[model samples]
Target: MNLFSEIRSLVLDALAAMQAEGTLPEGLSFDNVAVEPPRDAAHGDMATNAAMVLAKPAKMKPRDIAEALAAKLAGDDRITGAEVAGPGFLNLRLSATVWQGVLAAVLDQGTAFGKSDMGQNRKVNVEYVSANPTGPLHVGHTRGAVFGDALASLLDYAGYDVTREYYINDGGAQVDVLARSVYLRYLEAHGQEVAFVDGTYPGDYLVPVGQALKDKVGDAYLNQPEDVWLADVREYATEAMMDLIRADLAQLGIKMDKFFSEKSLYGTGLIEAALKSLDDKGLIYEGVLEPPKGKKPEDWEPREQTLFKSTEHGDDVDRPVKKSDGGWTYFAPDIAYHYDKVSRGFDELIDVFGADHGGYVKRMKAAVSALSGGTVPLDIKLTQLVKLWKDGEPFKMSKRAGTFITLRDVVDQVGPDVTRFVMLTRKNDASLDFDFDKVLEQSRENPVFYVQYAHARVMSVLRRAAEAGIAADEATLKSADLSKVNHEAELVVAKKLAEWPRLVETAARTNEPHRVAFYLYELAGDFHALWNRGNELTELRFIQDGDAATSQAKMALAQSVAVVISAGLGILGVNPAQEMR
Candidate 1:
């Protein structure tokens, strides 16, 4: 199904033949040999670097080897011709039937055509959107949520056993703030005027939590001291905030497999266990760190602290585990969390953090490297900022959230499909400008609308064919005689369809889900190109007038495009639109 792979295999077989014929060395490795689309389409369909990579090893000129290999490659059925280009690059043109077969392959596999085994069933834990559990998820968290969710789904499609998880930061000062905010709301529920002071949450989202608290225990802690209500209200407010966050994620159709609480690490000896693992390896020690190079704090001084020798594994310097105050540093709990993940026997770990957390990446990766002793690879992805634009001006502020835009606000305006698709139209590390006015437009310039329109138009063609009493179901179309439907434009779509499986493996290997978005866009473009050709050439139309045989064959091609679109959207966690509305 992968045309590039098929061509590469042919090239490798030809190289093996050349080795036997004594045209090349006996043991030169083919590891670096690669078959890729030629830079310029006019040269050929595919090109290989086999000659260049093997020339020095074999002690032979690259052009001499390329000419010999090209003659051998020209004998293969899939490769119609092979010729040496500039600097001994071998350009290959695949036979027309190979492109024709790709369409049939797509029809056979449907949406599963591009699914890959690149992950090899490895277990991977993806931790993302570990936002503070003190309020509903804002727009900043929305980008992380969508990026993480799409990444998890992409790995799953690539055959990894992925756990989509969120960390609840409820054991910090933020939860205490949530408790005091809810206490005020609780008093207000009991008919008392309460003023929110500095360091207290004043968002309306918590007013309901406060009212719920008053309903649970009416007038019991009305004027009491902070000791009794602080502990209980903190628990109450955290659960309430999590509910709002879960609802916001649900609006985007995101549901995590797990939500790990930071509070669970408290008093559980978990921090000691994680640190003990490092201690046993002689990584933990007592030392004083030099102050950060630039903009040192006024009170900065050398203080004895328990540290982890993170520099041994690639950190810029050793990191502190516990401060001189005997309390664990913020890094300690995170180390324990990752240690727990490693002990669970995961084969790999991926953390999706905001771009602001860039400073923490090295130490975190060092911890995983030490904890797993290089057995597991940890990959960290940082998503950049998302700027909002409207009315030719920077559209700042969230109307519903008062201080920031909640994830729900964006989802409600554009729907979950638009939110997921638009977020992925750019690479995760690149800042994305989201124009509310432009994203909602129904035109080719809008990628979301354009991609969805391709799928919708295919469905419309099927519906019209069905009304005309020609069977256009997947089963019927799949059984059509595809050989009768071959054309230059039709073959172009099939060739593009053949790239899906290879594209999936490349995207998964790079841990880049934006490639999936780009692939879908290209696939849609190819399908659209073919669709427009039908307007000028009646024979190019998908539905032939009163000719069910040719109509079934053409419908088969259209449905093949849908198959790839659905699979690509599945990786991005967006639903494929069946209708334009």
Candidate 2:
């Protein structure tokens, strides 16, 4: 059970009882009622805004309402004390038994302790890592992959029906470039030397695709015209590139529920259908766009084109659907793609894009809003750039600079778990520095190591307890005399454990996976603080000679920390480390 939510229910019940007894006004709104840990531990265990929210509505003084509510709450067996503080705020100190119950609850639930039903089983489609299928994924795409995957797992824990999707950008001119690049490799596979020209991809990863093509077709299109080879080679190259992408994602432990192909929109009437839907809504119109405001290009001219009236929804201006040349603009198929998603009846859509695409967020949201009539909400998460560091120096990579680092470059140096966790150590909108040396460092300063060590410490305690002939299993430890856990340091951990369910719900509601990472860090810090404090005071230690019950009680507390750490790491898609080495 969620202790916070459980206590919140008690507060609500007391409020309802007040209304029944005419102590409070009838039909007063209590929508803002919340039970959460106070900002300072000295204040109390939990605080609520019930008095302040009901003040104006009940036509009573907030302090007066708070005083009445305090008396009502103090009567509950779980709340040891409830008092009105400054400005009518009510702080309730829960009995130690309630915090003790959290440990028992964690042992009972194991990794499932903090799982929530906040999502209501609604279908949510999280589409991320929509990188161009030209080569192996680079560092930028790796961050997006980790963010989206962790978010999907977090949503699943919060009870949403989450579908992890990847939109492949294979229909664009980029794939044509990929085809020519592979054709050059195809020529090389026939034992002919080829130089990667200015327009072709030069990554060594494509060399294998070239060799594979030669093995399959035996240079059938060697020295032939583009017409003779372009079609077959484009299909072959995209498949090969996707295979490489799949392997790269596998390295990071990301598995997509579906890979939506952009090429499939061509000649399928999907673009036409999507545009027609907008046309019927009067959102599509023919217009001449103004020359961009600040800087007009040398070729700038007013031209009539098919435009989506996105401003009607939320965008700053209407956007082009078909270019002046009468060809569908790049955004035309994208609108159709999202329209297809909306029609498929997903409750929500989330797009994880690179931070450089920040300009595109408004229009995308506008399209989904127009298509779904605001019934389906769309959240676009822009992941900022990852700056790689090595040997205390900034590492720069760009294909143009001939220094671009691929996803494999990062994964090969550091294992997938370290790579994934380090990628999420910062918020998606914040620039992240991924250092080969820092992420792999075995110290408390590294968040990955710190959290892992907390888990490992608990396991060590379990082993020690086992060797001492004490059963450290959940049944025995949970049944031990938990009254021995009276120290403030030990109870601080229980307080952190009490916030798990609430943390899961909040993080999932905001589509934030980094919050889980931050929570684990805080929880790990609390456990470590308590563990170190035990060094200064022997009674705080987990193992006590000639005292099986107290030892079992402290071991139970240690196991509870591991349970939460495992659950949190599970959401992050990181395996819990049984040992640091």
Candidate 3:
């Protein structure tokens, strides 16, 4: 069903035939040979660089090789014309029947038209939005959550066994800080006036957590010492914050398959086991790290410590596993967590982190490399900041979150569909501006609206056809005589539909889901362009006047566009609009 792939196979077969006929030398590698859309559509429908790539190896002139290859390709029924361009490039035009088949395939496959088997069922662990369980998730974590969830869906569509995971940062001193903050709130719940200190959380979201603690144990830990209440409150407050986070994610249609607790790695010998694996490979050592570049810290001193030889595995410097006080460093638990993932036999690992954690990428990759003995590969994607604008100014901070806007703040303003679609409108590493006024605007400049409007337009067409008593169901569309869809403007849409399977493979391979959004926009533009043309050109309209056979043929083309849009939107975790209000 992939027209590009089928054409590439045909080109390769032609080259093999040329070799047999002595038009070219034997045994030239075709790995680099590519068939793709030409840079200038005016030149042809597709272009191939086979002659240009094989010229030096085969000891033949590129123009000569291209001429021979063109003759061999002209014998095929699919290719209408193959002409040699500058130097050795071959520009090809496919027959109209090829595009007709592409439209027919769309009706046959529906949303499954572009699903790929490139992954071959390899297990991949994608860990994202591993924010600290201190409060509800903020805007930065929202971007990571959307990106990670969409990536997991894209991988699944590409045939990978993907696991959506969240690593909870609950083992560090932050949880103790949360416990103290909740204790202050607990005192307030007990009718005692309390002021939140600079180090404690002051968000009103904790007010309920404090009341829940009071409801569970009435007056038991009242005015108690730190040792008596800190442990119990830390556990209770962590679970409460996680519940809030889960609710926030649900507001955006994100659900993780696993929520790994950082506390589980401690007191479980897992940390020691991960380090021992590194030690067995001579990657662990007792050494002193050089002071960081630039002005040194006031407390900087040469202290021998347990370190990992991360430099050998691509890190800029060796990292410490233990601090001078003999406690595990912050990076120790992360190492153990990744090591546990590798031990689970996943073939690949992906981590989605906020832009501020760009510095942690090399060290984390080094840890996984050492732990897996260079078997499992890790890719860390950093989602940049989101600037929210409203009423021609910056959006104010959420009163509930105290310092930043919560995920619920964004989702509540615009529903989950708009929020999810707009979050992926930009690349992950690029900064994005989520403008409240602009996103809600129903115009072509808004990608989410443009794509959704196209789907809605197709639904309108189906409804009109149904009222007109024209049978345009799936069965009729698949069996329609698509030869009537012969106009160049209509063929442009079919050509774009033909690119869906290829687009899915490219986006999945590069781990970029924004490309799906980008492609949907382009496809919508082409379909809208054709739709506008039908106003003046009576013959180009979908429902031909009293011609049922011709109308079903053109309706099939419009429905096929909707099919691909639904498939693309599905990968992005956005619902196709049955009708745009």
Q: Which candidate is the best by lDDT?
A: 3
Residue-level lDDT of model 3, residues 402-487, one tens digit each, is 88899999999988988999999999999999999999999999999999999999999889999999999989988999999999
How does candidate 1 score on lDDT? 0.89
Model 2 worst lDDT window (10 residues):
395-404
> What residue pairs clash in candidate 3, if any at all?
none
The residue-by-residue lDDT of candidate 1 on 124-173, one tens digit each, is 99999999998888777888898899888888988999999999998899
Which of the predicted structures, 1 or 3, would earn the higher lDDT when compared with the native?
Answer: 3
What TM-score would you give candidate 3 relative to the actual structure? Answer: 0.98
The residue pairs in collision within model 2 are none
Candidate 1: which stretches are off by over 4 Å?
295-299
Q: Candidate 2, residues 1-581: lDDT per residue as tens digits?
A: 88888888999999999999999989987789988888888999999999998899899999999999999987889989997899999999988888888888998888999998888999999999988888889999999999999999999999999999999998999899989999998888788888877688887778889999999998589879999999999999999989988999999999999999999999999999999999999999889987787856776878999999999999998999999898999899999999999998899999999999999999999999999989999999999999999999976564531447888888888888889888889999999988889888888789999999999999999998889998888789768788888898999999999999999999998998999999999999999999999999999999998888899999999999999999999999999988878
Candidate lDDT scores, in order, read 0.89, 0.91, 0.94
RMSD (CA, Å), candidate 2 to true, equals: 1.7
TM-score-superior candidate, 1 or 3:
3
